[model samples]
Target: MSMDLWEYQQDEVMSEYYQELCLSEFQERAIDEFTAERLSSYYVENSNLLVDSFRALEEAQKVSSLSPTSGLIMAAISIEIALKIGLLKPIVFGFVHSEAVAESISNAVVKQTGIDRFKTLLVTLLKEISHVDIVTYKRSGTKLSLWDERGEVQKRRNMISHKGSLSSSQDCQFAIDVAEAILNELLPDVLTSLNLHLQNKVIVE
Candidate 1:
């Protein structure tokens, strides 16, 4: 088949790379290993969900007084996103060779679980991945369990999203508290385990 200029250049690059790999001792791995090694770095670099979550939290805070309902929704969304990307993805990726498989399983686990089972799933994920005792995690200056706060805030968020119910400033603050607690308490450990660092609002190793 005739190749375009870009295709010809690509083939030449691949050929040179293949020849270099053939001579290298590290090239003896299986194709899946090669794929994983090449793709895993890309996944980690792009998959820091906390970056967006922080942005959401900031927005939630700004709108808390002006629009409590919006604040509550954004806060809840941030927590949900952080739970999946910050906690779930890197944890599950460690157990799989391919990022593709880890991604599919993560999506399915989050999607298939209903609201009733959400707490159980969260408990299991935190326990297995972070070894965190969810029951003992309390919000700042309050005796409220972080897990229960997460549940209540999220339930309110669901009511707002599904039934178009308006939220009070207190509810917005409640959701924000949950977001802040999770971000402060859980994020550091999670980031450390993944060898990730937050710098100037960017997440990196």
Candidate 2:
């Protein structure tokens, strides 16, 4: 289905669920306000952090050959900052989506079904955010197995952080490259997911 059609359908489903579940008006309003305030604050804080990390990474790339240990340290710091910011963007977006779903569901129930079912809608919205896989960590030999690419990225990131030993210019450059790749591939995807969740008002269930 077209994205717009899919979103309309989701809103319809949420409306039905809300009416069927029967939530209170007060509870529904509270969830809406709370979600908005929290999401706004989270976005402000995280976006700034993301920008700062991006600037640092750019500066690092221009530097002449760095000592192995320095390169690894800098790369590790940059990656950590980038990943944390990336993860936060989606989570905040998911939270906003949940809130919107709750609001839409509440409105639909009151308007169409004449039911007071806001509590269940709010609970379900929270549960959806709770379950979303906004970020995943891939350690070696873990239950949620890392694919080859992710595994390689993780290894390189780790080497930069833990290897500490002197690395050649090539090794340092490689670490920087890995960090750059992760930032490029993961950040945009995270932002897009957040925007989709917000625009569509989708819940996990």
Candidate 3:
């Protein structure tokens, strides 16, 4: 809890599953009344899911040592969520400017009822809309984007889920790092478009 919020009471529930909220510094930063009025629900939903992806990153790190496979799977899930909701959905909505069209496209991309694969959709959207060619989007000072970024971890997650493949702490850490990097790299654009500031124990930007 960054703000040490004083609660009047407590819920008779498990704190382990509770998620912390980002208390916006609206007092310090002046609110844009006009923009606030025109804000889209797509933006709000995407922002919340992006925050969830980050939260999953932290949870994966926390469990990396105890259960490597679980950690790896969690990190992989975070990557996929960040990819769709964090980057693709917002960018699509930004261009289309119609929530209905955007929602339909987003659902199709995410659901993928054997029409197009999830990974295929992700690459196509990144290349066509965002102009981010992930294949050529190399890591800084290295030609390591081939597997270190997203694909390898996703494959590993599939293996673990379908084939019960065991994983190591190193694998878990790598997945966690990749998930965090992808989310962090794409986060600024989403936040800026939404005209929102983010802060918490895990995220301070």
Best by lDDT: 1
Task: Evaluate all candidate structures by whole-model CA lDDT and list the values in order.
Answer: 0.64, 0.46, 0.56
Clash pairs for candidate 1:
none
> Which candidate number has the best TM-score?
1
Candidate 2's TM-score: 0.42
Whichever of 1 and 3 has more lDDT, that candidate is 1
Q: Rank the candidates by lDDT, best first.
A: 1, 3, 2
Expressed as tens digits, the lDDT of each residue in 57-99 for candidate 2 is: 6655756264554664566556655543434332324333465
TM-scores for all candidates: the values are: 0.67, 0.42, 0.62
TM-score, ranked from best to worst: 1, 3, 2
lDDT of 1: 0.64
What's the true lDDT of residue 204 in model 1? Answer: 69
Off by over 4 Å in 1: 1-44, 113-131, 193-195
Model 2: runs farther than 4 Å from truth? 1-41, 44-46, 64-68, 88-164, 196-205
